[model samples]
Structure formats: structure tokens, C-alpha cells
Target: DAGVTQSPTHLIKTRGQQVTLRCSPKSGHDTVSWYQQALGQGPQFIFQYYEEEERQRGNFPDRFSGHQFPNYSSELNVNALLLGDSALYLCASSLANPIYGYTFGSGTRLTVV
Candidate 1:
């Protein structure tokens, strides 16, 4: 009965650098979604992965990319990182779609210094 799990609880990157964050969804979940949360702000949807394909995307630059594996694990990759990319990266898992709600992890704290 493992819940959502995110790797590298914290990350530090330099401007122009690239980083990848990994996530393993909760048991029984098949859809994964990524979000960016800034201080005092609600989470902003980054993208969603289902059936190993990107199903939906939010307002973000091409620098942000993602991948989903057959086992329902996922990865979020950010390239040419900017200081503005500093935020909390969250991974949420749902049964088949997000409309039913999601179970989230603590998130990865990314600091772009």
C-alpha cells in the first residue's frame, strides 16, 4: 500500500543546467500528473501522463519535459533551467483520470541558485 513517492526530496541546480526528478505513483494508480508550486501559491499543473503518453499539458515552456514508463512511474525533466524554475515540484497519482482527485507526495524542493 505504498503511496506516491518522489525522489531527491531536495535538488539544487544552476542556471542553464538541467535536472530530472523521478516519481513512483501510489499503488493502483495509472495516471500521473506534475505540478509546480511557488511560495504561497496553489500548484500549477505542468503536465499529465497516462498510458505512457502525455495526455494534457499546462502553460509552460518547452524547457519542461516529462516521460512515463509502463509501470506507471514518471519523470519530470527541466532543461536550460532558470532561477524562475525554483519551486516545489509535486507528483500526484490517480486511478485513471484526475477528475476523481489525486494522491500527492511531499514533493521535490528544487532550488535554482
Candidate 2:
């Protein structure tokens, strides 16, 4: 009965370092998607995964990647991070054919210094 969950609620990294953020989807959910929210801006879609395969991707660069496990959990990885990459990383989960809307996690706040 749990909702989406993200690990390392907050992280601090330096330029050029890599970071991996994790997320556990809600029960009975099979799709996982990632988003990035910069300060005042709304969440921007990064990518989506279903059935362990990436289904759709946004305008993000190749540095942004994700993986969906068989259990429906997921991970978002950012390589060679830049200060501009700092943002609130959000994870959303829902059924493949969503009835309502996706359940989002509290989000991982990444600070690049």
C-alpha cells in the first residue's frame, strides 16, 4: 500500500561527478518515469520505462539515463554532472495504462557545488 519512494532524499556533488538516484514504485505499478524540477519551474519529463525497457525520452541529453527493474522499481543516473544539472529529481509511478494519474515521490534534491 505504499506510494512511490526515492532514496538519498538529498545529495551534494561536484562538477563532472556521476550520481545515481533510486526509486521504488508503488504496489501494482509497472511503469516508472523521471522528471527534473528546477527551482521555480515545473517538473520536466526526463524519460520513462516500462517492462524493463525505455519507452520514451524527453529533450534531455544522453547524460540522463534510467533503468526499470522487473519488480518495477527504477533508477535515474546522471553522468558528468554539471552545476546546471542541480534540481529536484522526481520519480513517478503508475500502471501501464493509467486510470488516474501517476504517484510521485518526495523527490531527490541534488545540489551541484
Q: What is every candidate's alpha-carbon RMSD to the true fold? A: 0.9, 0.5
Q: Write the per-residue lDDT of candidate 1 for residues 2-107, one digit (tens) a residue.
A: 9999999999999999999999999999999999999889999999999999999999999999999999999999999999999999999998855778999999
lDDT tens readout by residue for model 2, 7-80 = 99999999999999999999999999999999999999999999999999999999998898888999999999
Model 1 / residue 56 / CA error / Å: 0.4
Error (Å) of candidate 2 at residue 107 is 0.3
Q: Lowest summed-lDDT stretch of 10 residues in model 1?
A: 92-101
Q: List per-prediction Cα lDDT, in the order shown.
A: 0.96, 0.96
Q: What is the lDDT of residue 20 in candidate 2?
A: 99
Candidate 1's C-alpha lDDT?
Answer: 0.96
| Top candidate, metric TM-score | 2
Could you tell me every candidate's TM-score relative to the true structure? Answer: 0.97, 0.98
Runs of candidate 1 exceeding 4 Å displacement: 98-100
